[model samples]
Target chain A: MVTMRDVAREAGVSKATVSYVVSGSSLISEKTAAKVRAAMEKLGYSVNHTARALSTAKTNAIGVVTSFRNNGACFDLSAGAYLYGIAAAARRHGYDTMLLTGDDGVEAIRSAALSRRVDGVVVLDVLIGDARVGALKESGIPAVMLGSPADSQGVDVVDSNFEAAAVSLVERLYDHGHRSILFIGWPEAVYERKLNYAVRFRASLMEACAMRGLRVGAVYAHDATLGASEVIPRALRDCPSATAMVIHNDAAVVGAPQAFERTGIRVPADLSVVTVMPDQLGEGMQIPFDSVGIDVDAVASHTVDRLVERIGDPEMSARVELLDQPMHVRGSVRAAHED
Target chain B: MVTMRDVAREAGVSKATVSYVVSGSSLISEKTAAKVRAAMEKLGYSVNHTARALSTAKTNAIGVVTSFRNNGACFDLSAGAYLYGIAAAARRHGYDTMLLTGDDGVEAIRSAALSRRVDGVVVLDVLIGDARVGALKESGIPAVMLGSPADSQGVDVVDSNFEAAAVSLVERLYDHGHRSILFIGWPEAVYERKLNYAVRFRASLMEACAMRGLRVGAVYAHDATLGASEVIPRALRDCPSATAMVIHNDAAVVGAPQAFERTGIRVPADLSVVTVMPDQLGEGMQIPFDSVGIDVDAVASHTVDRLVERIGDPEMSARVELLDQPMHVRGSVRAAHED
Candidate 1:
């Protein structure tokens, strides 16, 4: 096996320089980094992961634990794009990802980080009063949470700014002269479990609507097709005075138009609607709608950067991150009383 | 940390027996497995992964690489549910999974498996003449391909039997006295790139149609709204005599009913259709259709089983496995000339 000394000699650089390049601890000039890489490739210096891990207490790998939220069944998932973002970002730092699944994310973190298989961990879909966040606080591992947790002061956290998204989306409708709007939020079970985003979005939506003198009607919609079909029509019927709808549930929105159509409600003609969802989901819908979209790539970039930074400097305090979620108005909203 | 010897002592078993339990090499009795697990939990033996990996030449983690396959952009991904199955299975085996992305699957395999970061590998949506398969063959990594490759002799292969599915679906339609069929195949580029499933399904459908003395009108439809809207109706017009439709493209089928609806063609009245898709995708569609489904759980279970078996015994020959895909007849097919 080629050693670091051999790589340093081949590149005419110091051992520390080679280490810096490999570990990504400090910024090396592109020229020097290129030279180090070429020398390592030529000398066949595949880092002895075990040896290096022991010396630096760092593994060029990030632990990512994904949690699926559905009924008891966890197979109904959509974390591919989100994970693709994190993995792409990690690869840029020459790091691989260790994936751990199942609901017991706290245990996965403990095993992976305690065993030194990963330098730090990135957890997805963090909930309020998250046990994983508590586990991280206890483990003292350099980590980042992709979803905002309830108590995230001391931990690195990045979220899509759903609080702002909810407020702005409703404000947009309020400015458009809509007073009474029905809000389709995540299922009651999701809020009961305290997924931070779903609960926070509802609170912000209601508060912002109130500030703008708007009457708000909030209802829960689960992601399943059957759940959406049953709940959306009921919500529409319950909110006869509402002239607009703001949907934060992606699955519900997929079937919401059909539900509305079956109830003899015309989209944008009688009631306007905006959504909080990914661009792809909105684009695939038969009824075009305005949306505050999740920028997965940006979220991934920020997450990896924070995790890498934490790994490099364990003493650094946690960060609060908010991603851009611009609303794309696509003719889904109309003036109130257009009828 | 509690050591392996400590676990062995607590379990009242030899250290080697404990190792066998951890490595999953031998079929330790259920009673023994339970005792070992209980002891490990009691003593908190999380297993020093790096040391164990070095000693046993096993990481107890399988490497999974994903490649996105839609027009140059990689987001048209469906590998999530498939991966969920694998991760769920790996957890059952007391192992975790390592994920790598980008189109450089060949390199990911070379580095991940060669470095012993993973005991084996699983590649999804394999193409003909896949470089990943070639790299695995040369590297001697315990691996399996989720989709069939052109040269699969020396590699473990597990694929949803799309060829059999196409033949059976078409034969069922033909049995109902439908002699003229319109087949909407995958995009030309997908077939040209030689994705095994697309090419094989098309070939099988054509051959089966010929065997039935049926006239087949084939057209390629890319998974895009524009493509489906234009191609489906055009194919319907061209195949005026065709009474049944077979679609292998998921995206095209999502929009096909609307296309037919616009052209004054009523489903199962003027035209009957069957699709090759996942049950979830078909269930989410506006127009209900019969479907031959890919059971992702079975694929995941089979892929993980073969890879684990190979990891336990490297000399084992490559195996070919096919998953059973039942067709769900959902009122999409009707007798020819019924109208």
Candidate 2:
């Protein structure tokens, strides 16, 4: 309950000097700042953030609106990594993150902004034509979307280019002399929800395959029901001539070794396997496979940077940013002629 | 910036009535509350949370302090699950979670509490003799610990009983006529940090093995350098007679199939495997294995409940609650006689 006045008196300085030091103002001399800090420590004086926020009309907090609907027993690894990146970056900028996980993302975001609980907001798991985008624009809050919506009007967007990764992955497989390929996608539910990343990846991969005049087959693998074990064999059976497989599902990729073992398929011998997922997930897989590594940290870091900039200058123009990740060739692809 | 007075004048009600409605007080009549709400909507009068917090001395936000140091490219699934649970629960109680992740946990916690940025705090990944425990106690804040420290004087704790799970796993293995067992634990770095869960699990497992007079060999597996592929083979070589294995590492359990395939050790054929992990992780494994299922949701839910309670009534007594999780017997373990 010690106030700044008590510290100022103890340090033999004016109250304005104590305030300047507490607010990190560069106007104060180093000696004066040190004296104020020492007095604050001795008097156990701490700044009341609420009162300061009221006076400055700014809260050193960011609202992070994310959805956990798709998460199963195991939380989504990619989402978790992005969240870690955001929290770390926010801390570096002297901000805390207020996590808002209400099922209705638009309402959650709108409320946070209207209440002035945070200076800016970060939206995660953006869907095609997401309602949150409209809400954010209407709220007039400095906002950033971790995933791109089909139509983003006023918010900055930072996301991994899954569409590019998908297209590039197909080209790599085709260059390996693989004429026919089987593409395993995420659960039907994900696409049904109109999640931008999965839908975009599937469309881009198919477009790339058609342009190459390559024979391709596709199947949707559900995490709970149609897992890798069932999806992998069914795709192979339907496309008997397929010599390679491209999996865009994290669970399917993690479970690939078991699927191949049960179906009696040898990697790079009978079939070539490539996955499009974050490198973090690929590293955890029991067997290494060729992958287009999505850098979740990069996307998150950029989103935070843009949002912080917009918060500082609300007139900053909004733009879309799609980061290109690396392609890791871990010897899981084989030449069709050799096979 | 429409103020409460604007809404009050538009509604033809007293400013105090609008204040009561904004604070969610039941003293306001339903008709007056409806009028105030309609006026607020028409005038676009949003509550200024900072000003309200200065007057009411409540933020309706909880601070969640967690560490991500152990995470590699992939985030820890269990920690992520716990975080999701806490956020979901907090939202249900009309509270947002303020995530504070700093390497110096004590400083992060003390700053959040002393600044009154949150109504309460929930600390994750508590270490043995954690410095944060002392800081929290000294700060005299309403706090809860998701993991128990060796000396928790003034905090409520909610954690899964890893010691009990370890003891039960050993007993189950022993009952299957296994004498010698190989136990692979988390990375050496985790133990070096004195993480409460890993340190407690290892100690309890060793203690239980001794009680049953079972021969056990232990090794620390690092996620980066000494991964499962290297640790599993080395442990097998050192404990050649080991007919059973208890793995307390998530990465090691995940990579068991690859290690077994390379080492020519078949599950339930050459060795029986039992893992100590959350059921969420157990379900994600390509190969299902025997495991003690840690209910991360239950722990997180209880921790939030207690923390909220303490926030509401600061005089609430502190107590420790250890949740007993279920054991799942998959096809990974087999009788030694059958082998």
* Chain A TM-score relative to the true structure, per candidate: 0.83, 0.94
The collision pairs in model 1 are none
Where does model 1 exceed 4 Å of error? A1-45, A69-77, A226-238, A256-266, A283-287, B1-46, B69-77, B219-235, B254-266, B282-287
Docking class of 1: acceptable
TM-score of chain A of 2: 0.94
Model 2's chain B yields a TM-score of: 0.94
Give the alpha carbon lDDT tens digit for every residue of A1-339 in model 2: 788889999999988899999879768989989999999999888999998899898998998998755643323656667777899889888888888888889888778888898999999888887989989989998999988888988689988888899888898999989889998877787887878888888888889999999888988876632168777898899899999999887777766775686677889899998988877667654347899988766777888998899999999788898888799999999889754
**Which pairs in model 2 have colliding backbones?**
none
lDDT of each: 0.77, 0.83
The number of the candidate with the highest lDDT is 2
The 10 consecutive residues of candidate 1 chain B with the worst lDDT sum are B69-78
